[model samples]
Target: MDRPLRLIYCVFGLVTFCQASIIPCKDDDTKCLVSTANDIYPKIMSGDASIGAEILDPVWIDEIDGSVTILKYKFERCTVAGYKKCNITSLRIDAHNSKLKLNLMCPEVNLSGFYDINGRLIILPVQGNGNFSIDAYSYNINIDATYKIVKTDDRKEYITIKNFNFDANAEKGAKFQFDNLFNGRKDLADSVLKFANENSKEVLQEFQRPILSITYKIFIKNIYKFLKAMPMDNIFKQIYPKLHSFTCVRASLTPPTPCKADDTNCMMTIGKSVYKQVLTGDKSIGAERLEPMKFDEIDGGLTMLKFKMTDTTISGYEKCDMKDLKHDNAKMSFAMKITCPHLEVVGTYDMDGRLIVLPVQGKGKFSIIMDSYDLSLTVTYKIVKDDGGKEHLSIKTYQAEAEPIKGVKYEFQNLFNGKQDLANSVHKFANENWKEVTLQFQGPIIAATFKKLIKNTNKFLKAMPMDKVFL
Candidate 1:
């Protein structure tokens, strides 16, 4: 079939296939919008792998970190359930103005994760890391978004959300439970839990921003995927002849040549090319801009040190050099090392307790200039045959390590809460002990920094064949 005919057939087939759940609606048809949402919510949340829409309910979140006036918290490996139970209480769609709003309510919702917390909570010190559970009754969520129609170079049109806001509230408040608080001290843990439950409403209000921010990300991502597959113009109407499925777009890199199995130097050169593309982000290849990498929050700690770093930005990656590359073809693994002469990290930090017996308590802006920083990464992948019978590399997992070879300089503003002399003394002392401080906390920082690196690498590799990338 020709392109036009195939598209027509697809539209006809889709209408026939989804007629029970979906139908054409006018731009201002509020009843149609709500009815259609209720009908197709289950299918959408169940996910359609063909369109690259991953499962939305029981959503998996890798990490979430945020801070309020006095409390900082981090959650990892979180699973949020109950969105599937939500009902669209109200909805607004103004296609003429490129705006959308949705109001959802769920009778009950639950979240479980590993959490790390620091700072003060209602006149009590809150610090710990362990399993956590939060249950909210009669949860409500409101989403508002405005998007622009973007026409891609391929002449395909998609909706790019310009502004998004997500708000969450609970009718019956929430309950919080955290295990292993204060190193599993039953007495203190009981007291803290009791107090938290009593003040759950206020506490939830304070932490709602970060939590809802992540939920917003999840919803927006799915919306983007759905809109991309079914363009904005075709979303509410029966005509979808131009609908296109989502797929990874590969970067335009130097042509590949077959390399000998033991040619490590050639591998290093190819690795450099991949890194450049991944680091710089090529829109042509669907890579997001990463020149000045940014992270909203990162939290981790040692025995005595608990810290939160927020609004962090790191630059100077373009000047990095690939030091070494090694491959184990039989084992399907690769290890590489890179060194950068300088990297500047700027962020605000909230820290408490001591590091190596040095008092370190602060909440303010911080700057760290790392000299001769080396990063090493080990990646293991498996080759899988796609539906088309072409082999692609699927990254199983990756490990990253960073070390500052020469030294590091640190400057923090507002230490000791703006005591000039005390802040200066602490800064001097910290600069002298930079290595120890970094050693205690750099593990998580480095991991957070390289998360995008690994993700982009995998993305780049996923769009190509193993032979194309390595051989």
Candidate 2:
């Protein structure tokens, strides 16, 4: 009886010790991350019931709609296989920024589903309603994700994804098969499928975005379940530690390049470095994070043309190029010309009145992309003495001017009470007349953006002495 009781106790302890099978990875340990992922990939692919993880080998998607130039297609009740056999080729974890990237490659991925297709696939007319299958050979996927840690009411920590992006590629291309084409006429179906398979690369490229969009959704859902069940510390042996103010005060500061009061070139170089650091939320020098900059709301447009945007998130500012920099020691001021490849603004909007010539009214989600976004900024500052008699730069005035060089793209969902045709027409008109749209809209937008920049710069400068920045 004593021996049996001891044996039972040992079994219980073993089960408790094996609660998490994944080997933990230290912060930013790429090798460990890859090894751990590889070790657990099979279990995750097969669905780990303990973690409530779903089987990913046959990832399911209810529906997907996509268009390429003139080609439009839809797939329903899709199931994709071969994920179970995928290998993690690379893994990069930037735990400091809560960002992770991993590469997955498989010999082949098979997709089977019901399809309704209409449109020109290259020169061939593709119109069909039946079953379909695609064999993508040498399939590869690159995934990038941003995540945040959430604490439950019971004080348990979990990782939740904030943003996710991915793209798919197949080196050996793909083969497509569509059944019951042209009312079960086999000849026409064979010809189209043959042509598509011959030019598989191009055909697959056309549908990649839509296909991957579904892939991202399903992939995130499963990964989220796995991550939620595993605590942050369990997945990562260590989380990147934040720098405290006391430590930062004693740390050595190195300029990107040597800088002087009137050196515009050096200033530009340093400005670029500082901008990047601030964007990443470097607390070492008291710089505030600007990535995914959020605004509760911004009100603008003509008095009659009242436009309000809420829960706004601005991104793509990191792609900015400092075209020109000017520093004036006499006035303690600086002027800069910064151009970004694009600036993306996403938010919910409430608008009433005329946008240029068209009368527009809506309250819905909006996404605007400003291409070749040129911004000019002029900042004037004055030296202020702190309690310790240390001098710091205080912003006196901030000014900004902006222009969209290439043009702007607008997507407003649920616009005009879900008037699809009307909203699409409005989008076309706005895109065509983007200059007028920018002219009417850029002022308040640029002002609000620069306002945040000024606030962040002041915060950093307040922590830094005037001599430190100039010298």
Q: In TM-score terms, which candidate is top?
A: 1
Per-residue CA lDDT of model 2 for 1-471, tens digit only, reads: 122222211111111121323344455466876776676566555443323344466665657888668888888767787888889888776645666677999999998878998889888987889998999999888988776667888776665678888888888999888887777778888888889999998888877788888776766666675555444333323322221111011112553444555566666777776666656655765655788788998877432257888999999998888888877654445678988998899999998775654667789889998888888776655667899998776765554557689989988787789888878888888999998677666556666777777777777767776555544
Q: What is the lDDT of residue 410 in candidate 2?
A: 88
Off by over 4 Å in 2: 1-252, 255-258, 283-287
Model 1 TM-score, all chains together = 0.47
Q: lDDT for each of the candidates? A: 0.68, 0.68
Candidate 2 is scored at a TM of 0.45
Residue 65, model 1, lDDT: 88
Kindly give the stretch of ten consecutive residues in candidate 1 with the minimal lDDT sum: 240-249
**Looking at candidate 1, what is the lDDT of residue 438?**
67
Q: Distance (Å) between predicted and true CA of 447, model 2?
A: 1.7
Predictions: Cα RMSD each: 15.4, 20.9
